[model samples]
Target chain A: MEKKQSKLSIVTNGLLHENPNLRLVLGTCPTLAITTSVFNSIGMGLAATFVLIFSNMAISACRKIIPDKVRIPAFITIIAGFVTVVMMLVQAFVQPLYQALGVYLPLIVVNCIILGRAEMFASKNGVLDSALDGLGMGIGFTLTLTAMGFIRELLGAGTLFGIQILPDAVEPMAILASPPGGFFVFGVLMALAIMLDEKQGRKVDADPEKIGCAGCPNSKNCHGEGGCE
Target chain B: MLVKSSPHIRDNSSTQKIMLDVILALCPAILASAIIFGLRALLVIAVTVVSCVVFEYLYCRLMKKPNPIADLSAVVTGILLAFNLPSTLPLWMAVIGAFVSIVIAKQLFGGLGHNFANPAIVGRIVLAVSFAGRMTAYAYPEVTNGVAALAGATPLVATRNADLPLLTLFLGTHGGVLGETCAAALLLGGIWLVVRRVISPVIPVTYLATVAVISLLAGQEPLVQLLSGGLMLGAIFMATDYVTSPYTLTGKLVYGLGLGIITCAIRFWATSAEGVSYAILLMNLLVPYINDLTRQKPLGGGKRK
Candidate 1:
């Protein structure tokens, strides 16, 4: 007899409780490196989703046939095949996006989120559950990446998907457009997410114990508990 | 109930203390600048410090917050800000920089360690954009002559426009900001800060190495690049800022290297000559993720993956 978790749980889990980007913090390189615009985020997210879905299905189908001893290698091979296909398709049709994303497009092959899902959930679950998990996770990642893209592009460049969202009089915060700005936005958003979760009477994922450099020399006598907040 | 109430040893370190230590370590550079630029340096420093402190005080009071200026953080910020600017910088510019550094960069982001980018760098960049000619225009101290020296190009300006002598740049005879004019003094201050345990050595060493390597690769004078402009000041002070810099040793090295590489690229290739400020500001934005990736609790002590 199979015990069932409702599908709503699967979707909501990705949205917050089990968010791949915020909670697990997987796919961070792409999240930080390529999210300079809404288009980039959408492109990265869709490409990753496609890879995730196919990889999840392939891994689940061959889970039993593949030996446990070499499961990691087997998983890598499957992921590589899907990623190669994604690369060619992007190069052919979405060349602009492929150019914008650069190396990060191919890096999706090793993205921790896809690999993490394959190792933890896809391998053990039935094909349907695995498919749902991939879809939920894919959507969650797409939304988060897009949100980050929206904030970075809107504030950094005064554009979202290349459309101006702010008045001309307002000076853009140029730092938000650069790599350091990306991390700053990422931290603030992550902190806000935790705060909102707590306010909504949900279990917040933020652990002050784990938020920063805890034992760092600077942390000991600086900023109350850490050097700086 | 367990009885244990006698005078227990409390850690003497505090944000205020660390900030004060950094200011003290920076005193040499500040004093050196006062000597070089004379009363002009003192006036600029005073304006910067007072404006930064006043702005922070007013903002906190307006925001209905506790007086954060008591921590002496704004004081440190002011000193660092003055270090980056030319000693002959107009009083209005320094005051404007104070407002921007305190209000926009520091207070807007919730103050102190919460700012994403270093406040001093932000203020410098704003000044650079608003007054490009003034920001880059440099002047030598008028010690021999009675009259104040007119504006002249720094070694970096010379390097960009017409490559200058490396030795002259190193010796600080060339035109530049007050403190940045003396590479030797900045190095001494950096060493003092490191020895005092005020800042780690990773950032300064790695940042310098990266810039040196990149400069060599680009067929430029590595020594000149190392000694010119704000590279020393940025690497030693701004890049090592606790709130904006990475924490772990590995992360700090990576952060420093990244800053150096970015700085070299901007200086040699890009149009901007003030590369240090931009590079450190960019690295500051990356601090959180750097700490996240590098901060590993002891094995068996770590939270679940």
Candidate 2:
């Protein structure tokens, strides 16, 4: 029962507490760029999620065999391989979404959420936990992107999934569909996430000491000094 | 008498007083716009002002912050925002502009003195980008025999093909946004602000001179370029806004020069006929950097070791 609860928490954490896009603020470029419409956001989210899960599982399974000195490059090679597979599958099945996502689909290999999770959680954890983490983080990112896209599409274009919801007399704000609108929506949503997190009485756990020198990935290299006076 | 801290002195000027002076200075242009654009101009201005005040009051009440409506800054922002818009703009759209100016641009950034850019400029730019067609649909001046004239393009749009008599431009008989039509009224208002010491003349003078010099070099008629579009209104009013503009004299000059260059670059090369609002917005963002570079050293202070 304890093990099952831990597994569920690992997934639920990403849904809110450690949301890859909103909480951790990873993969911001894709978050802001492809979130102009609901369709593109879902396509990009699922594609990244596929790559994320496989990459996390593979990296966790190979963590021991892969040398510490070259672990980063090894992880990247694994991520890039899975990214290519997802890209091909997306291209074959969803041609329009594949085109809409364009360069972003292939750029998922460089998404920080994938690499950061691979380094932080996957490499030292069990393969099952790593996969769970990927699933949760992926859902979080997808939900956030979809929320952003929903707002941008509705206000900027007065449509949802390409269907007009507002009356014809209502002039949609065109700027909401542009880069500035994307940024505005992104900022407001992030604020809402933070506000909700606070209202739920769950501390964000930003304690500096917890994330300081001891928690740093470079702790081993810097001899735990971290250059602080 | 209650003893306070030593060396205490205070000026009679408050935010309310200063904003009132600005409103008074804007009266000539406001009257000119009403006469030129018809009573709809007054309606537009009234709606924006009321909406701006309401938004500010509501935001303050919701946030539980001190209400700032009494300062009259929102009134100034409302007038300036309406001035940037066409008279034919829908009333609802004007209210949207007010919400942006007051709630988003001003209050969101901590209000009044803390706003990074002029609220009106942000509102104008957002409205322009969102409703390009309506924002640019200029109504011709209706000063002839009290009849609504046909819709026409602003003089800036026709600058290349036609030579508009400088007098008509001076007298404010033209198709343009509400306040930008009359150079004479704007100048009158600008001079009033300067004489009242409410605003320094450095920014407006430097901005206009730079535009004049650049226009001459570009082989365009300098006077027409200076008098056309929103240049006169922008240089005289918006660019000199205290909160967004730099403090030091040298910083002010640099800000003015940058505005002139960007405005001319857009007018000459870009697809847009008017660039005054955009130029001011861009320069406003750079004020902090300018202030840092031009900060004055204390008297008898030496360089840090």
Candidate 3:
């Protein structure tokens, strides 16, 4: 029962408490880029989730064996390998989604969420915990992207998953599908997430000092007395 | 009389007074728009103003902050935003613009004085980008025997290769956004603000001069460039916005020069025929830096190391 509770907390933490996109603000590039359409967001989210879960598990399992000096490179290698696997599978199965995602698919090798999880949680925790963390973080990211996608697609294009929801009389705001609109939606969502978190009395850990060296991937190499500047 | 404190001088020009002056100044343009574009223009203006005030009130209430609508800044923002839109733009879209201007741009940033750029400019750009087709469908002012008609592109768009009637452009009887149509009316309004000392003429004069000089150099008709589009409206009203514009004299001049250069650049080189709003918005972002650069040194102050 204790183990189950711990596992559930780990997953729930990523969903809202430490949402990789809204809270921690990891992997912002993809969050802003592919969220113009619902289909692209889901596809990208699932792809990243697949990479995240496998990468977390692999990193956590090899945590003891990997040297401190070379751990970042090792983590990247593992992440890149999984990202490639996901890319190939996506290309083979879903050609349109693969095309839609385009360079963002390959760029997932360097996504901060995967690497951040590897450094912040997976490296210090057990494989099962790391995997659950990945799942939670992935879902949180997916939810954020989906929400953003829903707004941008609905308002900007007047459509949902390519289905026209707004009547012909109501013109869609074309800007919402564009880059500025993406940024606007992303900012509003982040604000809303923080506001909700605060309202629920879940003290938003915005200060870097509170997150401390534990959150930093370079903490292992830092020789600073108190913490990194 | 009761004994007062030692330093007893105070200017009676409160925010409310200044905003009221701005509204009064905008009357000529509003009247001209009504005469030119007919009653729908007034409807758009009315909807935008009401919506802007409502949004400001609602946001303050929701956030539990003191209501700022009494200051009439939102009313000014509403008028300016309405002026930026075409008369043909849907009322719902105008409300969206108002919400964006009042709530997102102004209130979210700590209300009127704290907004980084002019709220109306931000709203205009957002609407322009969002509903490009609707926003760009300029209504040509043609009142044929008591009925108004929409026809042709704005003078800026139409005059790319051909010259328009200078008198018609000066009088604002051309295709354009509702408020930008009449150069004469905008100038009248601009002069009123300047004369009332509500806004300093430094930014407007410098901005207009720069555009005139640049247009002359670029081989474009300087008079047409100056009189056409939202150049006068933006320079007089939006660029001189106190909260977004620089403070010192030098800062204001620099800001105006930057606005002119960007405006002319966009007009000449870019695809967009009109660049007044975008130029103002872009220059607004650099106001802090401009203010920093042009900070006045005190007497007997030591030079920085």
Winning model by TM-score: 3
Cα lDDT of model 2 by residue, A182-202, tens digit = 987887787678668877886
TM-scores of chain B, in order: 0.89, 0.94, 0.95
DockQ of each: 0.05, 0.85, 0.80
C-alpha displacement of B294 in model 3, angstroms? 1.4
Ranking by lDDT: 3, 2, 1
* Best of the two (2, 3) by TM-score: 3
Candidate 2 chain A worst ten-residue window by lDDT = A214-223
Give one digit per residue, the lDDT tens place, for model 2 in B137-182.
Answer: 8888756555322435677777787777799888879888999989
| Residues B1-305 of candidate 3: C-alpha lDDT, one tens digit per residue | 89788768878889999999999999999999998888999999999999999999999999999988899999999999999999999899999999889988888778978998899999999999988898987666765654322336677876785677799888887778888879898899888998899999999999999999999999999999999999999999889999999999999999999999999999999988889999999999999999888888888899743
Clashing pairs in 2: none
Q: For candidate 1, lDDT tens digit of each residue in B1-305?
A: 78689766877889888888888878888887887777788788888999999999998998789899879989988988888788767778888888889987889778887888899888888776555666665657664644322335667766765765565565565677767877777888888889889898988999999999988999888888899988988888888888888889889888988998899888878877668888887888888999888886887785836
Candidate 1 chain A: worst-modelled 10 consecutive residues by lDDT: A215-224
When summed lDDT is taken over every stretch of 10 residues in candidate 3 chain B, the lowest stretch is B143-152
lDDT on C-alpha atoms for all candidate structures? 0.81, 0.89, 0.89
The value of fnat for model 2 is: 0.92
- Can you write out model 1's per-residue Cα lDDT over A1-229, one digit (the tens) per residue? 1357787776566776567887667888999998889999999999998888889989998899989999999998999999999999999998899899999988898999998889877888778777788888898899889999999899778898898889976556666778867876787677666666667676543445765654322222233444244
